[model samples]
Target: MTKVFIIKFSIFILFSFILSTVSAFAQVDVEKMAKNFNIYLAFPEKHFQLKDGKYSGGTSPQDFANVSIEKIVIKDLNGDGLDDAVLVTVGNYGGSGGFYELTALLSTSSGLVQTNSIVLGDRINIKKIQVHSPEAHSPPELGLIKQNFEILIYMLKHKPNDPACCPTEPTMECFTIHKNKLIPCKEAPEPPVVKKPALYLYPIKNQEVEVEINPKGKVLKTIPEYREKWKVYVTKNGKINGKYNYLFYETTLNAPIPEYQRGWVVSHKELSRWFDVTLTKFGLNKREIRDFKAYWLNELPQFPYYEIRPLDTQFVEENLTIKINPKPATVIRVILHFKGTDTPSKLEEPAIITNVRKGFTAVEWGGILENSPNSDIKPQAKYSFLAQDTGVVVLRAIDLREHKLSIKLSSNGCTDKKALKSIVKKLEGINSQVPHYEITLIREKPDRCKALISEGTTIVYDLKEEFGINTKLPYTVTVKNPIYPLITDEPYFQFFPKKELKPKPVEEDMSLKEHLIKATVRAIEMEIKRYETSQQRDKEDKIDRLRNEIEKFNKMKPEDYILGYPNGAESSMEMFTYGPLMPPIHRQVEAIIEEPLKIGSILKLTTMTKSGPFYHIAGINENIDIAKELKQGRYRMKLYLVYKREYFGFIQNYYVYIAEVEKQ
Candidate 1:
């Protein structure tokens, strides 16, 4: 996890604490100001009446803010000899900007009272504050001289055309007390726009939704301290207070959202208009849409154009694991993942799903702004998985033999051994006697079509040869959350030798060629029967032609096929489940491969366990065994075509399961 933190007031805080403690030792006007002091900002002045140098209050909860005196300098102002206090106060609301103000606490017969202050703008840096009183001076036109002392404020201000984040210009302000109010002798600079990935939650109507969110990344900041969840009585306007309103948090997204394969390529000038149209299409209200734009536009890096896309909303909601009580009737989460580009990119458009705000609705809008395809921002990998591109695999059966750990993963018929990847690392031990190791298996590539043996796919990791583990000793491995206790000392669990664990059949078993032909015919017939009921008429010719091809195999005798595995041998294809044969997901891609390849080239075969694409395959190790059975002659073997899908909505995540070498 790479964390970038800007310590905004580190020095100011330390100095404030020291000054506060020193002032506490002796009763002074500063102490009086720290307690119950009055602040006059505008006419009919609103009294802050601060306590303990800190105050929290506003017109309402929606505009609620927290204010603290960050730094203070003691000096005699008004030429009154009694020491007056110059204070820098910081106030932060529910959102990004922090309001910094320059104020004074003057000593009078009535005690310390806060005078009229000046808005120093957001994120203004104060270098020093000095009180300058000449031996003789004349009053100017603007009602001068009741609390007549000049104040010199040296600070850093943002220059014109500067991004709200970095204010590099050095400037100073001169002020004088006029009728007890601090009047700025110069004009104030515009506030700098602060930015980060801000995700806001809206539950329109009297806190109708109680939300609990486990984000895919670490939270940088959250108002009201996000402890598990937030339950705020939000107003219909989505504003509860000036300082606090709807729940919000900030996090850095490490990469582009994987589900976004298509979106618009827009120029810098088009960002505002693009956000309006796209956000409206994705179901954001007027207020939500406006807020999203306001938060990023000021600091958006200038680019010729940008490639912007959105993650599947359902994917975001589920992956973020948003839980709401009195559940929202509709949940709409929009995140614009964008990268700066040189020009408009030609790409496919994604389908947009619009939502309506009814009853109790939950709306969330955020964005990931990446200046380039590859930036140095390395966010924490707090997410479970990056994307759902891996093939159909749902279960794992693990074993360890010869200091090697083998994981047999459940695959649909398309699962191939080459498509999978695994990594192993020896972890620091939790127990002195038991060695601990961690392993993860990811299907980097998915099987689309291949000769599938019914047994599941097996991937191996050599602990002794690769990671230097003792072969004779027992060890423990962590896979996901489970600690697999591998009792390698017992040789009984090692099943990789293709053990003949099958029962003897009463009749002669079918040959390899006959088995393939029967399953193919049955599957093809089932597929043809399915499309027969569809309204489309063009597929009629394909159905008829496929039916004619299946009948030829049905008419052939099983004894005529010379390629036969020993009856009940482990090398023979078997059903992972029994019943009717399952067909391919796409009838158009159903194929057969027999390009003069030797049996030695056949490394893995997965049997079709479930119906097309939600593929679960039964696997067995027969690569070496099958190779030996076909030796002495260069023979060509036929393979089956199958598909598997996780069936996630709008995301098929299709993969071609190939052979130990087939799909090329």
Candidate 2:
């Protein structure tokens, strides 16, 4: 009986060992299963397809190039005593960007079969995937595993605040298999709100201190500051309630001094010593402190203060000049203002002042009236100065403030009526001239006008016509030429010849020329065969046309030929037609007169002649002479006409000389 029992036990142990080994082998191959799941998804067939059918069944398997399995998790989900598969795949379709999907496949006796699929979202990212662990619950409960361990997929979802390429929100999705179907389970709770730490600066007596505080307003720590004038800076970590992980220190000059001291000046050497001591107290090594001190010395400003003062209150020609006490490393800006307006208005664009030495700087204001008429100076105008790190100061004009003129003007001796009359008569002689008057005041000293004329000066003056001259001028002039009709030949039609029209030679075929000949022979044979097979009477006519076309092509040359048709209707007929011909190209004409004419001088055409098809100053140069003697005249001293094709048969340019006159 003992021997029989031992034999039975031995057989039982052997059977158990074999069964265990087979079970181990039966376990699912994760990589192989993932590939099969990807194919089952049929991504390639959906992405690339023709209207008639999908492009999926070729000899080679479809790669689904842009689609990839990002992650896979295997676990039992339905109490089936078999591991199930969950795959996260990402597909990128060119312009549409990327999309992510979650796929669950159940293990059956045959193979892994897809039970459920869920499209996550466009441009989503799969962060992680795993079996839902019951241990995650507080005071771990048994009911969490009721669904045979639910599948948990962790992904990054794109929120409104997220960028186009990166997702920002963390999301957890739970799924379970019930009744042979994948169903959604309860979602995990959202993460807790994080608290960030910040650094705040507060004034302590005569010094400043930096204190780090948590989001709840609780003090974390105080960053040590060696010098009373030093400032501390901190940067927060990535999380919303994250701690500040970085800190830096900088020396400042805006710190207030002790109340006991009225005024104190600190030298550069003393400041350097203080900086080194402060850095050392902050736990900086010798090398670091030395380097920081060197940097501070190099970056220190040379001058700390600037001063501006009005040089002259009374300005001539609306000019204003100011004196600035120069200081190195300081910038100054000067702006002018017009007074007696609804509000303080700028006289002109602001001027930048830079690169000054220790001496006084002088700034002049002139040409303000011509450049900025909108801000032209009124009876009462003022100027303002602004220095960097300093405030602005406004100063009244000296001349306007005092109600006096710096320069004297006398128009009593300046009169020329005879010259004005001559200019008017000359303008009246020209049909295109428009007569106008312009009076200019000539100053004995160009630099010193009737009023102050400086960099930003604006002068407003009324001209007395009795003491001025009337200048005759034409704003625009048109040159005309007579029209003439001429006949010419124009192209109508042309024929292009073809030397060789043949397909490229294939490696297995003959050369291009020989291939063409063979193709031609084949075409002729086909035509002949068609002609013989057809019962219609027109078949012979078609074959004859094809033969003629071949003959003509064979005899054609390589060059293109052009045929001319002079008449509109008949190609073979040539007829005379009338139309305006292009005008002859002429060189630009210019001349100078030795004497300057008055503002009202008139210019008249003295002669008219014919050249080519037009009559009237044709070949002669047409231009009004501009000379110093004619500077008093506001009108054109010399006129220049540039000939163009559009003026071919309209009008010709005429030249007029101004009569010499004596200056009064």
Candidate 3:
């Protein structure tokens, strides 16, 4: 059994983003509803009116018009991601019984629309009536609940043979809007859990870590490709040794949300000490605590006091199927939540229980700390990365000309090196009614630039040159990555070539050139993993820490196999860079080695912008020095060559980088 410990750390309440979502209740004439309103309920089958919140018609004790908006709160009721209104109204007809109804007013783009009305039992006394939890979170606390709207209604119902005025049997009921009607939420096994729970990973020994979870709902978003189940090596310092030092992946799962009442209540001033003592007890190391604080320190709300509650660890262990491999001996996971209040809430201190960190221990800490109105943190302005999600990469609108193929695709500014040679599988051709070919867009190298292009860039692939596809005929081009077709509708045109195609058909044997390109692309991708790496928290200190980590990593023992080193490059490769040999013609010419070449391979070189060649491959490396022919002021060039190595029986290749030369 995995001895896991989870903590919910609530630092302070701060609103994530200030959204202008005015509630429908604000527009609703609730005062008018309490005054003269029509009540359609079980007891009062006919229309009954309540003028000024009361109607006592002396025609009979049963003829009474008692209509009042008992509880009016604002929340989303129709899953439209907007604030709606829910009201509990009382009606007095048939003297002995009092009719209580649940009414929903859904908010629309134009105005509020009254949707459904439900009746609670007659002659029941409402104990507590509210929309949110004890925390009293506003409608801005969206994304927590998904499909349904919930309201807490606690009341006392009459028992058998009890007095008409007062007969009490207290009961609490939770009601959610279903299919535009309010119903008791008893069918669902558990209440929904909070979204974005960051599960940090800290392993004692340096080992590849992979966590797989089976959430009731889908895993909405998780960084570092959790869906792929990529094995990430985590160092003792809790850093995922990679280009980006991602420690853990947070997920939004559907499970029972754990609630904790027993915790410490403190003001913002007492936070530092609170973190040191409480997190220490929770078995978090100094480094982990620092990371936790750094992420939330600036966003901390400056309320008079706060209620810190850790979500129950049991809820995490059972509901969330978190399977860690090479199973951890000890695990500590904490999610802190802070509720800011006007006054200090006296809370009972819950006993913290966690096992000592043994071999292969794992520690995860994250929380959902919402902000109050008096929060110190102000909402930041939104800049538009504003591009629609690629969902990997969306490919559509394919127009194929004679030699060149124009494709409309999703891009992130640096998509020029998105792919070199693509694998085109002619699954169904000439024989089938709708000719189909599955084209796999292989991104030979990742676009390192962080430019967010609003409109995606276009990809113009030379059918005879790039992917080696012949576009003389028409055939529907289906991108196999997402099974999306190029030119989805009528007039689908794409020709799959026979001899020129680098990736041969799945059924046919691969040509020597196709086999080599496939092997080299894989090799280049593998080498790209170790490029430019750093880890930092979310504050000013994070910069310093990342700098320190990079320096430390660079200075590690040579035997440790330092990060950012070329794959399989044990000392053979040198920084392929040079300047002018003669003095009068002071030229600084440079060439980026696209790939390493074998002994007899051609030494090709081209201008940095790839407009024209500075010194193109005229002869093999063994025959001539390509640099000698360059006549330039200061030229940047690109060298295209193959770095092939025989791995026992299989062939492997690698890319030579520019950064590797800087160190030399």
Top lDDT prediction, candidate number: 1
Model 3 weakest 10-residue run by lDDT: 577-586
Per-model TM against the reference: 0.27, 0.24, 0.33
Q: Which model scores highest in TM-score? A: 3
Candidate 1, RMSD to the unseen true structure: 34.4
Tell me how far the alpha carbon of residue 11 in candidate 3 is from the true structure, in angstroms, after superposition. 58
Q: What tens-digit string does per-residue lDDT give for candidate 2 at 351-435? A: 2223342222111211111111121211122211211111111111212112111212211222212111111111122344553
In candidate 2 the C-alpha lDDT for residue 318 amounts to 24
User: Candidate 2 at 489: error in angstroms?
Assistant: 68
For residue 623, what is the lDDT in candidate 2?
29
Better of 1 and 2 by TM-score: 1
Candidate 3 is scored at a TM of 0.33
Query: Candidate 1, which segments miss by more than 4 Å at Cα?
Result: 1-209, 241-243, 252-256, 372-664
The Cα error of candidate 3 at residue 260, in Å, is: 2.8
Can you write out model 1's per-residue Cα lDDT over 1-664, one digit (the tens) per residue? 1232335466678889998877654346455555556554321123455677787876532234567776777777777666788877776543334556888878788778677676776566677777766433423443322223567777776665454445667876677665567766432111111123344445555564466777554456777677877766566555544345456766533222464668888888888998899889998877777878887565354467888777675756644567778686777777666677766778688888788777666677766656431222322122111122462234346777666777665444555446654445554576887778665555666554435433456667777775566757767766642222322122211212254343432344354335544545544554454345433456687577667766765776865433322331322222222122222111122222233222111212121111112212211123424344433333223333332222222111222222222232
lDDT of each: 0.52, 0.33, 0.48
Higher-scoring candidate on lDDT, 1 or 2: 1
